[model samples]
Target: MAVTLTEAAARHVARYLGRRGKGVGVRLGVKTTGCSGLAYKLEYADEAAPEDVVFEEHGVKVLVDPKSLPYLDGTQLDFVREGLNEGFKFHNPREKDRCGCGESFRV
Candidate 1:
């Protein structure tokens, strides 16, 4: 089981970390509050929890909690820019479907 970041995603995150100057890495997880039952949650992690599973790629660390690993494994994150819109996108092999609004997913 592993989670990875694309080169673009890693560079995007690394730039943000450099600007913020205090984060150890980025944390990725799931929350149950969207139309498809689960939504991705991401944030800068100043410190990792004891049970966090860490994956490092392109010099950027991605942290996943034990409880969220099953849902996130084999996922590759990418940073994208389409005209004026830009954000992190998830390539999740475990995802069975996503909501129409692109805010949530089901596995």
Candidate 2:
């Protein structure tokens, strides 16, 4: 029933917010798409909805909508560096399978 960001992720998000000068937090959600049927959606939230579930970790806020809560509960967002490529990765405990391309997941 909660989502969190890794220390690296929090730092990465904080740096971007610092540069942008405005943003309440990051919003995490799910969308139906890709080979596995669901893909992760992320965006910088300028404001929070009244019903948004907010989890604060490492000094960064992670927001989730009620509709998306079940699919994303207990997920941890991490910022990682692999060779020359670096990006945010999802550690979702509810995921039963991930697509071959790693763009989507099924639970």
Candidate 3:
């Protein structure tokens, strides 16, 4: 029941926060949409909610709400670069499959 960020992901998040000059950490959650029935959501969190489960790795705080914990537990997030595209990737052990477009997942 844990979520973590890779060093590269941490560095990228830190840089963004530094430039913005605000935000306590990043929030990770799931939304009920997309072809696979669930989509990952990421945003800067200025504060933590009472229900949030927080994990700190590489000096970056990752927040997950209680409802999303089951879906995202043991997930390791990574920042990756592939040609001209770059983004955060989710290494989720619970994922059974992902959509063709890679925007959503099923577990």
TM-score of each: 0.97, 0.97, 0.97
Which 10 residues in a row give candidate 1 its minimum summed lDDT?
A: 17-26
lDDT by residue for model 2 (2-107), tens: 8989999999999999999999889999999999999999999998999999999999999999999999998999999999999999999999999999999998
Task: Order the candidates by lDDT, highest first.
Answer: 3, 1, 2
Give the Cα error of residue 104 in candidate 3, in Å: 1.2
Model 2 scores a TM of: 0.97
lDDT of 2: 0.95
Lowest summed lDDT across 10 adjacent residues in model 2 is found at 58-67
Candidate 3 local lDDT, 1-107, one digit each (tens): 89999999999999999999999889999999899999999999999999999999999999999999999999999999999999999999999999999988999
Candidate 3: pairs in clash: none
Which pairs of residues collide in model 2? Answer: none
In candidate 1, what are the lDDT values of residues 43-103, reduced to their tens digit?
Answer: 9999989999999999999999999999999999999999999999999999999999999
